[model samples]
Target: MLTIKGKLGIEDFYRIIFKEEAILINKDVLTTVENSFNFLSQFSQNKIIYGVNTGFGPMAQYKINDSDRIQLQYNLIRSHASGTGNLIPEQYVKAAMLARLNTLSLGHSGVHISVIELMTSLINKNITPVIFEHGGVGASGDLVQLAHIALVLIGEGEVFYKGERRPTEEVFKLENLKPITITLREGLALINGTSVMTGIGLINTINTRKLLDWMICCSSAINEIVQAYDDHLSLELNQSKKHKGQQQIAKSMRHHLKDSTLTRKREHHLYNGNNEVTIFEEKVQEYYSLRCVPQILGPVLDTLNNVEKILIEEVNSANDNPIVDVEKEHVYHGGNFHGDYVSLEMDKLKLIVTKMSMLAERQLNYLLNPNLNNILPPFVNLGTLGLNFGMQGVQFTATSTTAENQMLSNPMYVHSIPNNNDNQDIVSMGTNAANITKKVIENTFEVLAIETITIVQAIEYLKVQDKISSKTKKMYDDIRNLVPPISDKDVPMYPYVNKVKNFILNFEEEIYACKELN
Candidate 1:
């Protein structure tokens, strides 16, 4: 369990999404916020502020008085509720809420304690507000989509409560809650930031990192079963290249396949004690998928590290305009809300998903080809070739998924057009990028699951009873428990696919933990 007052940071976000309970420390956050509000009072004469005392974006030039400021912010939310796309998932919306709370804890947005209290109520009560996946230009903040969140906060929009879509006002009333009154900057504070995009990208990055590690392990298992030449993954070769990703991947593959009896030794040991010995040599110096994996995957890891750093800064810093610095007794209007940083990160994440899908597609091709597979029918079957369709449809799925990923990888960062009539001309499109990346990640998982099925079926067909590494054998058996051998056509595979996903997601953790115990 974790709690956030003013001390919330990146590690807390990670654990919370990983299913840890999170609590709020409002008292501590209020202390800093009180000082910020006092500073605003002292500098009251210099109160010409954007997003605080005036209309936003193109209308920033219009001066709004104290009496009308609250209405202005309220109207801003209602008008910007123009999000017209698929509604974001509940978990993602919850994550965005958490991120917004984190940014507010910095106490620079001039939001009152009541707003924080309402946010805490929603968190503790499991009131997930509805937010859509489009209409954020990532400039002037994630305004349109987050407006829906703001509307719900004021008990005016829609929400998914207890797994049912209900009016926000009804849910609040049922929970004995009051709609928060819009304050001077509270509404703007609620919606004016990069939280929506950054939160999605951060979660995507974390999950993708785990998947990358699992891919290395799974690929090594395949290498051992196929008797790939260890020369390609040799430490000497990786050291000569000196890329961290390459070295790490090579080291990991070697470690995973270290004790396999199926692998070939040095050149001199090729001959047996008896007569002529059979030798297995791969046709290519390396399959494009296998050889370039490190190069393609390394940049993705490096880019993710950069994105994590940026997200840490975004989450911990104030992003709203007209920030008050009570310690310095000053207020400054700035463009902290621009989301170019998060946009590029999301673009990179989509690229990583694209690579994963491509790798899986290639592996699927390898397992299906008679020449490449060496053993088994045209596509790893039990009986004669034409009689059984085998894993034919699974290969079709892999190809289609890879194609989808490629299309989604078109960088959203570079597609900025003027929004709000040149005021937000150079938008980051960060929110769209994050949403697309999430879709790509889902598609990549489907591709990887199919590849796992294909490879396990191919290995079973070869019937190599010789002992593989302990880890590899365990994985094979795990897959076998869910998926029976491919003996005939027209077999129902949906259940097997679901079972494979369940196994693969948890497989690495179980294997590594068991090895550590030993």
Candidate 2:
């Protein structure tokens, strides 16, 4: 079990989200939370505190009475729990809950300690709040999606407990859990932040790391299949470009093709030959997709590194309104609830991942076209050319899915629509950005899986698997284990394609041996 203290780091997220480790809150954090609540209890006694003594958003013109103060929080939570569309998957919800818990642990949100305790229990029990994919403008920071979380905190709404959607009350009762009482500002504090988007973005970034490694492997494998010159990935060539991502990508490619017998050295193949033929058969340079893996995926790596940094800062921040300061003994109101940070990062991430998918599609095309790769049969079909279909049908799936990723890469950050009586004008559509990014990411995985299968088929037709690098051979063996080389005949391909997708999704290994994420 992992213990969350004052701050949360990226490693903490890896432990809880990926390693399936349960978490505990430090006692000092609970003390800090109680102190903040006490300070707010006295500080807001006569002053007008937003979302506490006054109505929320455009309704702040009206003041709430003392008798209705506690009920006000419940009203906000229940009313805003109006999110619609498909339910977000359980893993993302858990990450969001972790994000919210980490922020509240900072003690600036003025939430009661019961709030922290209840969230800890929910997370440890693997009981996730049922959140939807829509109804958030991200101006007030995932208002609708987080309200579902607030609703569950008060023992209302629904939760996915033990692999099923059940009433929050039923799960709480089964687990002997007690709901948090509305003390001061738990409702507004819980819902008013970028936790939802941060959570989803965190999960996306983690999976993106996996996708990138696999894409790099596929890129290196394709170069080996075509017997491309190794100078394109030479240390002298890529390092001179002055990009860390480029140098690192070239480094990884060198490792992958280290034992490859197919990739030829330009000095050995071209320089040694003194033939005076005007038009030699071998092409000088490969297509950009195979040769420029470093130049293309370099920006992808740099962007991913930046995205991870910004998200870590976001999760550890005090992102709620009316931040209560026990040390200053004051309540300060501001717009820390805005989600522009998460929104912008998600958009950038979506755009880069789409670019990766496009690269994969182009590489897959080069493998299928007989003219581009004179090494393999057309479509790598070992059967009668026209009578039996080979990988031709499956290539369509890769092409269409890549087109969808391109379409989905349009930025959601610049497409905000004002709501909340224009009080939330100039909003951030962060949740939508994150959701759409998730779709693009999953689609890219499918596209890469198709590309991976095609690369293996080319290797099989060449019958030079014995000469391939150890890395490429492992990939070939893993894929061939799922389904044999699609030669002599083609079986039903949809299930086979999905099987590869699932393999990509579930497969975990350390491919970034030369470089580790910072």
Candidate 3:
């Protein structure tokens, strides 16, 4: 079980959320939470506290009686639980729940200790709330999406337990779980935060790392397949430019292609007097997609590094309003719930991921088109050229998916529709940005999968499976084990495409490790 301490990070998130490690609350963290709750309870006596005695947002003008204060929280949970669209998957929802748990554990939301304990129970029990993809303007926090999470905390809404959507009450009984009772401001604190967007953004950041690692491997393998010169990925060439992303990508590519017998040295071929002919037969340089991988993907890596840093900090932040300050002895109300940090970062994330997908698509094109490589058969077809269309149909899937990513990459951070009587006049559509970025990331994985299959096909056509580096050769074997090479007949490629996509999505074991770029 992972213990909740002062700060949480991406690796902690991975172990708890993905590895099913139960969480243990720290004594000091819970003490701070209890102190904050007690202080808020005494401080709000006959005092005007937003979301406690007053209505929320535009409705904050009206005051609530002491008796109806409890009901007001319930009302907020039930009324705002109106989320439309598809349910967010279990993993991402759990991530949001963990993010919320960490923030509340910070002892600033004026939430009871039971709130943290109950959230921990729900997480450990794998009882994910039924959250939707649509709701969440990003500013004033993910109100609609988090409202559903809040509803589950009160035992009134449904939860996904044991792979089935069951009523929270039923699952609570089955697991001997008890719902958190509303006291002062549990409802307001639960939903008025950026955990939903931050959680999803954190997960997206993790997946981007994996996708980039595989992308470098694929880029290096393609170079070996084409027998391209090694100088493009050489240390001297990449380090000449000081961008960390470019140097890291080039360094990684060099590691991946180091043992490759097919990759030629430029100094050996061109620098020497071997270039006796006026017009050299061999193509002097590869296409930008092949040669400029370090430059193309370098910025992507650098941007991703920054994105990860921001997301981790956001996850560990008290991103809710009415922050309870034990030292200051005050309940400070402000816009900490604003999601601009996550929104802008997610927008930048999708943009870079789109560029990465474009690079993969171009590399796939170069391998399939014989005119580009001047070596491989049309479409890398090992079977009958005309009848058996090799990788021809799946290419459409990759291309269209990449185009959709280009469209989805448009900034959701900028598109804000003012709702709630314009009380949230300038909103950060952060949750929308996160959800769309998730789509872009998932779409890029599909493109990479198609690119992987195409690269392996190119390897087989050249009969250089044994000639490539151990890193890419193992990668080739991993893919070939899943989907065998195309034979003389044109089989359905959709199923194979999906298999490869899912493979890379969870393929974590790297063939070799490189220096940490960051």
Candidate 4:
């Protein structure tokens, strides 16, 4: 079980949502939450508290009567539950809920302890609220999307229970769960935060790191298959530049390529005769895809590291507006709800991932073309060259996918538009950026899948299976276990490609378990 004590780390977030760990609020944190609520109760009925006594947004000037205050909070949730487009995945909804619960547990949101318990109960019971992909300007804290989730808490919206969608009220009654009563500032506290964006960003960062590792591993395998020189990844060259990512990538490549008979020094490939010197060698160096793997992918690793740090801080932050301070007995209104930090980091991640895709595509091109490939058959066709169109069409698919990723890489942070009746003018499009980054990740995975398949095929054609590194050999055999090696006949490659893509998606955990890779 995972305990939420007003703070959540990125790795713990993944384990809670993906690993299905139960959650509990710390006792001390629960005390803080009750104290804040008690303090807020001391405020006068006529006090003009934002989202409590007064209306929200542009309507903040209008005050509600004491009898209608609770009703006002209920109406706010129902009205703001206006999310559109496709529903967010259950994993993301659970993550967002956990994030919101952690923020509210800080005792700054003025939410009742029951609200926190109910949210934890929903997660522990695997009940996920239906949140939409669209609807959120990323300002005023993912209002519509989170409001849809808030509606489920009050037994008024939809939820996915036991892998089936059901009405929230029906599930609550069946599960013996009671609907939460909205108190002063409870509804606002639920919706006024950056949980949605931060949740998506956190998961995306984790997946991106996995993809980077696979890319480096595949690049090393391709380097051996192409018989590229290993000097480019030498530690001396990398240490001279003094970039941490560059040095780390070079070290990882060397480790992956360790004890390989296929990799050769430049001198080993050169011929030195007793007579007049007549040099005989393949190219002096390799193309940028093989030669500059560390240089191109190093910066991407750096960018992802920086993005993960920012997201961790965002997840643990008190981003709610009108922060309740029980210690000072004051309510502070601030703009911590804005998602600019997450938006900008996601934009940067998108751009770097596109670059990674480009590098993968270039390596695929090198393996497909007969002239570029080290005397390999055209399109890696092992059978009759003209009849078998081995990987020709698949290479085209990779190119198109990489092109799509390039277009999606355009920065989304620069394209903010004024919204919310001009009252929320200059909105942050953080959610939009995060959603597109996910698409980019999906596309890049397919691209890497194509490269993985092609690299294995190239190795088969060269008959260098025994000469490759042990790590590369293990990776090759693992892939061939799932996807049979291409024989002397043509076969549809989509199934094989998809199998490899799924394999890559889960490969990170496998690596973590392997003592050799560690």
Q: Which order, best to worst by lDDT?
A: 3, 2, 4, 1
RMSD of each: 3.3, 1.2, 1.2, 2.1
**Every model's TM-score:** 0.92, 0.98, 0.98, 0.96
Q: How badly does each model clash, as a count of residue pairs?
A: 0, 0, 1, 0
lDDT of each: 0.76, 0.89, 0.90, 0.85
lDDT of 4 by residue, 1-518 (tens): 87788878876887897688898788998899898888888863557788888888888878888888899888889999998898888987888888888888888888878898899899999999998988888988889888998999898899999999999999999999987767787788888888998888887887788788888888999888777789899998999987788778888889888878878887664544335547634677788889998898889988999999998898888998898888887889878899899899999999988999999999899888878866688888777877778788899899999999999999878788887777788767888888889889989999999988888888888899999988888888888887776767788899988999988886644441122211
Best by lDDT: 3
User: lDDT tens digits, residues 67-159, model 3?
Assistant: 899999999999989899999998999999999999999888888788999999889888899989988897889999999999999987899
Model 3, TM vs. native: 0.98
Worst 10 residues of 2 by lDDT: 509-518
Model 3 / residue 132 / CA error / Å: 0.5
